[model samples]
Target: MTSQTFGVQDLTLTSVSGSNVDSMTQLHDSYDLAGLTLPNRVVMAPMTRVRSNPEGLATASTATYYAQRASAGLIVSEGVHPHVEGQSNPLTPGLATDEQAASWVQVTDAVHNHGGRIFAQLMHGGRVGHPDNTGGLQPVGPSAVAAPGRGFTPKGPQDFPTPRALSGDEVVEHAASYGEAAARGIGAGFDGVELHGANGYLIAQFLSSNANLRTDSYGGSIENRVRFAVEATAGAVEKVGGHRVGIRLSPDSGIWGVEETESRELYLALLEQLSPLGLAYVHLEATTDDDTLLALRKAWDGTLIMNPARPGGPTPAGPEDARRWLDNGADLISFGRAFIANPDLVERLRDGLPLAEADPATFYAGGDRGYIDYPTYRA
Candidate 1:
């Protein structure tokens, strides 16, 4: 047994039984996610397909796409905005309306009937969007700062505008939106909901030092900055219960201009604040170092779903990456792009078969070409 340094807090990392075939077998084994029983430990991490219709409704292909990947222990659906104002880009789905929620029923039913548990990841883009992409509604964040990049729209890429700063009251409302979305997701037949508290979206903007320049209780110090994330998590737990709710966090990910000055201390404080809610799991992206990840894994009391690659990064998590993470204290491993090209990812890994590669061209806002046309190896 190797003694690992967690943090200055003296938390220790307990080594896994070992890696290699043992890890692979263990990963494919069934486990309990809160009250939900997952058939394997491979999680299909949320990847925005951007194929939603103008009304933010998911189509039949969406159902087929996810249903094909039903072999995953958990399938976290693409980022769905809680409201139109929170929409990050064009053609992304939403969980805000009754119609949108009803639209997801088909998707949830598809995955469930195939023996897969699915979770809706509620994401709000914050300052990282353009008005052209948001139906003329300006994106809102904790502050009025503009993100450093362009956003996708029907007219092609457009400049990201300085988002309208949410008033103090509006800030509170936005925080509650996650819980509201979680309720809609539950109503839509989802097994659970994972709050998108990562990747420089609404939650990340509030957690960012440079992005969130407000002096209110929602920003400034580490304690203050982590407040919105805590409230969002609490809201989800309030609506759907803690066992059905989880959150994805990127400790030091600087994506979309969100930089955590003290990634270690910030996330530890966040974990401490969220521990009381008793969420089903905390998904951590490999956007930071192993030491910080180990500390976060130690600090989080519930399940930890580890993504072996950085959020929105180029790399895809493979079996070897998953094995190493399992050795490093990750309960479940998430795969992003790997799951995109390989619907039968679990079967491939379990049988030691080849993993398929996804085409980057048809990744977003397209027909069924690259979306659902990926064939199983046996096919």
Candidate 2:
């Protein structure tokens, strides 16, 4: 009998091999999550690749790309629009129509075949999108506000238009759409779904004081402002089991003019509401200090996945950072750009191998040049 090999390159000796294992204490440990026993605590965070077809369908290349990085304990796919109005950019994938859902079966099958658990991240861009990018349809948000700055469209960069405020009835309908999308994701072979309620997107827009200025039941007061996110999460949980659902939130992140004047209170209140839902996990983007993060961990009584890096930070999360967070309280640590270049990230971290640097130039320009061309470590 022979052991099967599973990386882009054959295993080889690296400078950090053998000696670095002791430093990765909790990072190398296994944990049971929502009935699934993950091999490790490393998670591949969701990232927009903009590599799908114009029809918002996943291509063969998408399956190949995800299969290459199946070594991660779990893989959260790039932000995928649950509906046409939720699409934020050109060439991003969606789970709206049957064709789009069917296209993802290949990608999911590829990951499962490689012993990987994957979750589809459902993102609604809201005002962050432009008509030029969403097939001439006007973007809609909780309020009629335009996000600050320009957005990249198919033609080029364009100013974001002021989105139409959804009526109370329409808000309910939009929230229900997330449930439909979650059903579609499960049907398409995804293990679960993660609602993108962060990074100044639709859910975050509703939670922001600057972006949401409405006086309706979905805005104004803290409870009202958090109503939309709560409803969206409930809708997703209703369709898919709570154990197969998760939500991502970036508290206090002021991107796209989404200023949370009362972030600490806002998130704590939101978590109090969501803690009883029995959701799979809560993924938080670490934009604040460690004390703040630990405070958040103490508040939420569920599995927490923390991305331990500020947006546009100089350094990416390494094994040391992972161990620190895991030791502190985080059940899982997600890596974004590190997984982009190192498809075999799990093995590299386990054996203490040097990681290849990713090219920033081709991060989102499409094609496979920077998508899947990076080689694994070798002798």
Candidate 3:
């Protein structure tokens, strides 16, 4: 393995060794995503790889990694912070600066060269971050609450800090940041942008009743709680055009001390507001039941990208899972960890080839060992 240090993080590259099976024609079926036609319906889900430099810029390795997995119907890049304070972990990429956006050009160009449509997932960590990770800037959220778990900082894992509550004006400003980042991503040659409103991030923090104890117009009622998400999505849509914007939401996920007691009402109201936006798609990390998923599908008339992961399972979605979600009205299916270890995931799944298990140890260790060294299937 070869290693290099970028800023305060060390990245390593190592090789990894997979077999052949029959083609899954259904999974290989093409689908129309906005104006872009995806060659297949297997999407590479946005995952946090932490492979960027200290200044929060994507490196050449980052470009190569995504380019290797360009076989997917669509690729959603890792969670990219829209601002410095929005970064939740060390070494994660960002779109907050011109240099950052320029750095991402390599990634977009690489993926595009391989005939892959890529979307930049704009993520704001909010209360999920620590000052240690954000260069001494305190994380900001809908309320002054700290996430339950520790955050991975440059020094080491540290306890989550109580974030400052953003004022109504500041909240609007933060929402606008998504739009700015979306434009930056587009400028960098990305096909589109996906707003990260899921997984207990800033938008999720505002949506969750437990995390958001605010009494302002951005909280309290379901409508109020969903205001930030709606505004953020709207802003992104306005900036990049609705056809180039998407939003990802994880309802009923209790991660990071976020408890959405009113998940149903909150998401429904949010969807109602977003349905008319004519956005590209809505990616759902489905933590709810079949009924709720069905309801969500009906509520949002546009395209739905569903990622069905078990409560605590380590495995990513397989062909069976894809079939199930597609039958249930999902326009596309996304695989996370599976893509981490299987660059040829689309071919592997399509041909029923055995998947290479991802090395859990190297997931966020900042390296190419488990990032890009996974080989394609051979007979």
Reference-based lDDT, each prediction: 0.86, 0.86, 0.86
Per-residue lDDT of model 1, residues 326-361, tens digit only: 777788999998899889888887777677777788
lDDT of 3 at 354: 69
- Residue 332, model 3: lDDT of 91
lDDT tens readout by residue for model 3, 1-379: 2211121011121211010112122567899898899999999999898889999999989999999999899999999999878998888999998899999999999999998989999999999998888778999999988899788988888999899999989999999999999999999999999999998999999999988999989888998999899999999998989999999998988878899977888899999999889999999987887788788998999999999785347656666667666666688999888888778888777656667777778988987777888777663
Descending-TM-score candidate ranking: 1, 2, 3
* Pairs that clash in candidate 3: 22-351, 24-350
TM-score of each: 0.94, 0.93, 0.92
Instruction: List, residue by residue over 1-379, the lDDT tens digit for candidate 2.
Output: 1112232122222222233323433565787889878898889999999999999999999998999988888999999999889899899999988899999999999999989989999999989998887789999998888999998798888999999998999889888878899999999999999999999999999999989998888888899989999999999999999999999999888878799877888888899999888999999999766666778899999999999887667766766667556666789999988888889888888776677766677888999889988776653
RMSD of each: 6.2, 5.6, 8.0
* TM-score of candidate 2 against the unseen true structure: 0.93
Model 3: how far is 74 from its true place, Å? Answer: 0.5
